[model samples]
Target chain A: MPAKKLNLRKRYGLLTRGMGWETTHQKMDDVFPYDSFEGIKITDWDKWEDPFRLTMDAYWKFQAEKEKKLYAVIDSFAQNNGQTNLADASYLSAIKLFITGVTPIEYAAHRGFAHLGRHFRGDGARIACQMQAIDELRHQQTQVHTISHYNKHFNGLHDPFHQFDRVWYLSVPKSFSEDALSSGPFEFITSISFAFEYVLTNLLFVPFMSGAAYNGDMATVTFGFSAQSDESRHMTLGLEIIKFMLEQHEDNLPIVQRWMDKHFWRAYRLLALVAAMQDYMLTNSPMSWKEAWDVYFVENGGALFEDLSRYGLKMPKYHELATAEADHISHQIWSVFCSLGNATGFHTFLPTEEKMAWLSEKYPDTFDQYYRPRFEYWHQQQKDGTFEFQKGLPQLCQVCQIPMVFTEVQTDPMQISYRVTEHGGDKYHFCSDGCKDIFEHEPEKYVQAWLPVHQIYQGNCGGPTLPEVLEWYKFTPEDIGNYIGSQDHARWQEWTGEDKEVKQA
Target chain B: MSDKKNTVFLILQDNDDARPIIESVEQDNPEATIQYQPGMVRMEAAGRLVVNRETVEENLGREWDVQELHLNLISLAGNVDEDDEKFELAWN
Candidate 1:
């Protein structure tokens, strides 16, 4: 008997654990381009299995239903001329970062998840990966469609995807994602699902949704909230997958820790964009980097660690480093925005005196002493046209691909700690050796970082100058920076004033 | 072969608040057929959802910002055909 065929119950439960896992996975030929993703491997399809136990019907039913709900809101808004009464066009400035930075990351996710759907060795993993692939596609499509309407009425809504590839600071998100996608299946799960999905998506999503509501962008708010709901499932998958891997073998502990350390710093570094948006981008309801990190990292992470401590992995290596970092990211991002605001499509007026006072009060530890001085300098230099750009090029980390952000903590008195590793006669610089240790475990792996500086020196990004490269991108002047004092701000004021009078009448 | 009874599918209130929103949907899709009842209006569309600000402005007594319409929507059922637009509702 060539492995006697058994009943469904003998192999897996009824519509549970792994139903249609093998069959649908075997249908990879239906999707095309499978052979090209990697070499042919029939065993790969057998390895695919879903943890969520979701079959095709449930998947389509849920997705179609979700799309319908989302479309209804869009329809209702259009029917009601809901776009007109927006609190401020300045609000779209926050989305400018998404259009330029975070949105493209979804495309990267699509590519990565599609890869996972192929290479993953079980039906459970394959199905989840496929669903994630579709989710990424849905995200990209809906975002473009939503933003297209604004493109008609607004200025900066054009070719953002191309801009993402060539832009300067945008390399932060790009390099971070490509690094994760380049990794093996296990590390990809650790970096993206565990670190990015569960740990950081809350930080990104909550603020985006809240800001959309405050600015009266209903469709963005609705879609963001709905998308985040699916993200919770992905987060759970990350949590379960991580614990499952760790428990499977004792040898997995150090391996798991190395990945945890590596991805924590990598993910944290890319979140500089979120840090910038929270600190500087929003015109009306702004959040500070410190406050967001406190709630998102310290509090949420504390709870998660309590849950995961049983798995032999500890809280991320740089918990102290990040907690110390809270004091610095806001001021750093605000500085970047203040310098670059003029060329940006978003607005960045000086914080109102009231807002300045609030900042001083909120950051009682360092705001007035460290951040306010720069505000005063820019206030004067902006008038004098003497503000200088930190031109030339930023030295990106070998692994994370962000410009080096590690520095001595302002609050701590006597610690100049940094992490580095040397492998095969080449030294790699990381913000934390936590990342470097992961790299050293397999030096052949991370040496191929797509650092923008390296790329420009290699003539990869259409010459180094910002304007020259911007030409190679899909961005207009409107998609670049700060939100206040922009054309949209003027229109916001114009529309709000007229609406007020009508309401009063 | 033919099952048709003068169908009353949707109901709407004609308060001035909703006229702008109701009218905007009608104008954008153009094919949307609307029925009006005492203190209500019922509109139906077999196609994609359309929410353009300019269309709503042409019909209302006065111009209104998009956020204000959240107060006017009572209930919705069925599915939204296309979701490329932003939506608002009354919720704290």
Candidate 2:
């Protein structure tokens, strides 16, 4: 008789935990130096659980099937001219943002997890991070391939990597990722896997993926489904890591809390871009950014934190401020983009009157009162031939790297919420108290920030003139400016046989 | 058990990947309320909710690993205990 096959748990144990052996040539401390420096103590590597029991054989089979399905959908989308079926050409702006701002971060996450896979002492964690590293790379590749179909027909889709490196707004996401990548392995996983993938991922993915489905972008929706399955594993790994840390040693609570406080604010600030995309970019919006925040953050995150309270972990600091800003950040960021439209990779436009009405309905408390009039004024300026992109560069926050556009919503919606600090004889600006506090904790790290606006003034970004800077950013004239008469808009009209005159009006 | 404070819930993205798991959950936890949102489904029960691997595999018509449930899981509220045979959530 054939020998009985090992059960799933034993098979996983042999494949993972059983493979790890004590190092004889090198000290374990010398081999894994980075994990201890962050002040997190793991008393026993044995306590670390394998959150998922996926073996390499099963992983390859599952991912291969997913890839096969994804590519088939992408091929069908290309064959059927999926671009022409979108809710509007305006919807592609969101995809453009995804490629430039979000896709590069996926690559960074791949690098981060690869580092973790190497540095982690526990075999379970190493294997998990290794799988996630591959997943991140897969996400980056699939996103590029999926959105490349639109690159053939759109203006702003080209040169995403080039723009991601040098562009001003893109720096927000770039800096956020770099901060995570540059941290120790534990903090990297805590910041990314826990704070981001688990706590805040739904806010990002749900909006974009659902927006794609709602707007008829079949390729993006397919990739969203494919990536989301992997995200689940990432989220579970996040929870397991945090739980393991908290359970191993009582001393780890405060250290974990501090990292959560800092990284939560970082991840939340990075999500400001997604807020803008959800609210203003999608022609047929799935839900308002505030509504998504309520569901994903307020409700779901509330439950998660409540569960975590057993480990003495509380809700992140400044969570109340984030909740308050949800009503306003999307509008604020969209306004900033509209002001600097000429300098951006994608076209920006004042919302149509219908969209403004939708915004008013969605944000009854803030939109009509605080934001609608500003958009109306911009619309008037365009109609009068007096509209121009803001000529002066906006001040960027030292920590978050977003422009100082957020307001003191808790006190006065009209007052810009600016915080200032001094470090190394240099005054630094922050978008909020959260960013300022993060800077104070590690002024050494933040002072080295590559503020793009300052870089341009210092003659670093391919000369001073706006046209020179645009050229350096790899942006064509068609790539920047208002979406109404832009090349993308015109091509969309031609493809869909819609009247340009009607669209312009 | 009917107290709101005792409630434990699990949310999964409502898609083909989760359909079998959701059905297994419905079968195991008859007392739970299953509500479908736009693209997600939430399963809530008083005090406890459990996912049995055998039931899921039966619903899936193949062998299923308990950890594969995370592929569809969106969020959950409660302390979790899991092994090869079952995954359980409760307000312990």
> lDDT tens string, model 1, A125-176?
6667778888887877777766666666666667677667766667678778
Q: Per-residue lDDT for A2 in model 2?
A: 100
Interface RMSD in angstroms for candidate 1? 17.6
DockQ of 2: 0.30
Tell me the TM-score of model 2.
Answer: 0.94
The CAPRI class of candidate 1 is incorrect
Tens-digit lDDT track for model 2 on A456-501? 9999999989999999999999898888898888888888888453
CA lDDT, every model vs. true structure: 0.61, 0.86
Clashes of 1: 33
TM per prediction? 0.71, 0.94
Using DockQ, give the best candidate's number: 2
